[model samples]
Target: MKNVSLGLALFTLVACSPVSQKNKGKKYFADLLKDVDKIQLKFFNHGDTLAESITDQTEIDIYKELITGKRDPKQKIKCDSTGEILFLSKKDVILHAWFSSRATGSKYDKACVTYSVEPESYGSALTVRSGQDIDDYYYKLRSTANRMAQH
Candidate 1:
């Protein structure tokens, strides 16, 4: 009877959150922002890590737009960031650059963690991963992402 009661309790908790269930086959960054005592929006690799912080609202707005914006399918995308763009976070520091990658030879174009701003690839989005669902962060990003199409 004790086992039955425990199982029932578990079921109730799980059932209450269909969103949790929907995320079963999916992945989320469980710990990217865990110990981050400081929340900063800074440039990843613009010039200097500490030098470029996102203090301007317009800059943030532009980032917000970029995160929410869809890449042009015909763009044959390559993320060079033009020195002032493509910024995303790695370890509390948002870098405008991504780690090295090789072409997978798949239909998908070459992608980096910071490069994928589309909604469908929610898993690696710089905004989503760094935010990592902390303090309902995904809500805003997801809202923007919803307007976009999958790769």
Candidate 2:
């Protein structure tokens, strides 16, 4: 009876443990930005400083949409993180995103994010690739950083 009870308890624990599901037909990460007021883009290679601080509501919305874009079906094995963007609500960071590319001039992109604010699927590391759109976004960021640094 003691062994049976232990086995049952172990089975229950295993059954109740939450599993991290792959981001297939799902958003890349949870929406932890409802209270986010600013989105700051920081580049790793470009002096690792704050490149842009998007406080405007319109721009914030646009960036949020771009950040929370769909994930690729297959998991690609490349992580050359170019930079990270911080989603902030007031002075606090809500979500921190690390963006990467498979290679320079490649269309593959990856986002490894950690949320300061928790959601249902919180604490799970996810990688999302959106091909050309992501590549374009990265170039836009790099160019913006370069353009701003010149002034």
Candidate 3:
């Protein structure tokens, strides 16, 4: 009787544990797609000076479209590997992107990607940087901001 009871108890503990099996199928960068549901853009001058920002729904939608459209759904996250900071979030969760000024073969460049997600908090808080796709997001943002400025 004791043997049966202990086995049942162990089984119950395994089933009731807080650890989740829900993430078994998840892949890296899976969180990024969900994280970008609502992103805002802001530009800085000289790396610290305020220059331009994008917050309106129209612009935000356009920016999201431009960014997500850059990659195929199956391979999008791979772009994050080599990017230089194409999608960045800063200053109250504002997203910014910048392209590298250095040549492709250079060993390193000042502009590079950094990624972080907050831990020991209520939920995941993600931060990202771009790699090779910097120009794709950066120029689009700059062009859109400039056009709005013209109007």
Question: Model 1, 42-128: lDDT tens per residue?
Answer: 222223332234444444443443333233456445542212233434444432333212221113334323333222332232343
Q: Estimate the TM-score of every prediction.
A: 0.27, 0.50, 0.29
- Candidate 1 vs candidate 2: the TM-score winner is 2
RMSD of each: 14.8, 6.7, 9.7
Clashing pairs in 2: none
Q: What is the Cα root-mean-square deviation between model 1 and the actual structure?
A: 14.8
**Global CA lDDT computed for model 3:** 0.36
lDDT for each residue of candidate 3 in 1-151, tens digit (9 for 90 to 100): 9999999999988986534432211233333433443443333323422233443445444444333212223422311222222332343443333322232222343433223332211111111322223334555655676687799
Stronger candidate by lDDT (1 vs 3): 3
Q: List the candidate numbers ranked by lDDT, top first.
A: 2, 3, 1
Give the C-alpha miss distance for residue 85 in model 1, angstroms.
6.8
Provide the lowest-lDDT 10-residue window in model 1. Answer: 97-106
lDDT value, residue 71 of candidate 1: 36
Q: Which parts of model 2 are misplaced by more than 4 Å?
A: 1-14, 20-31, 46-50, 66-77, 101-151
lDDT of each: 0.35, 0.54, 0.36
Question: Where in model 1 is the C-alpha error above 4 Å?
Answer: 1-50, 80-114, 117-151
Scored against the true structure, residue 133 in model 1 reaches a CA lDDT of 22
* Residue range with the least summed lDDT across 10 consecutive positions in model 3: 118-127
lDDT of 2 at 85: 66
Model 2 Cα lDDT, one tens digit per residue, 18-99: 4433332124333556788998766565455435577888767655654443433364435445656688998798777665
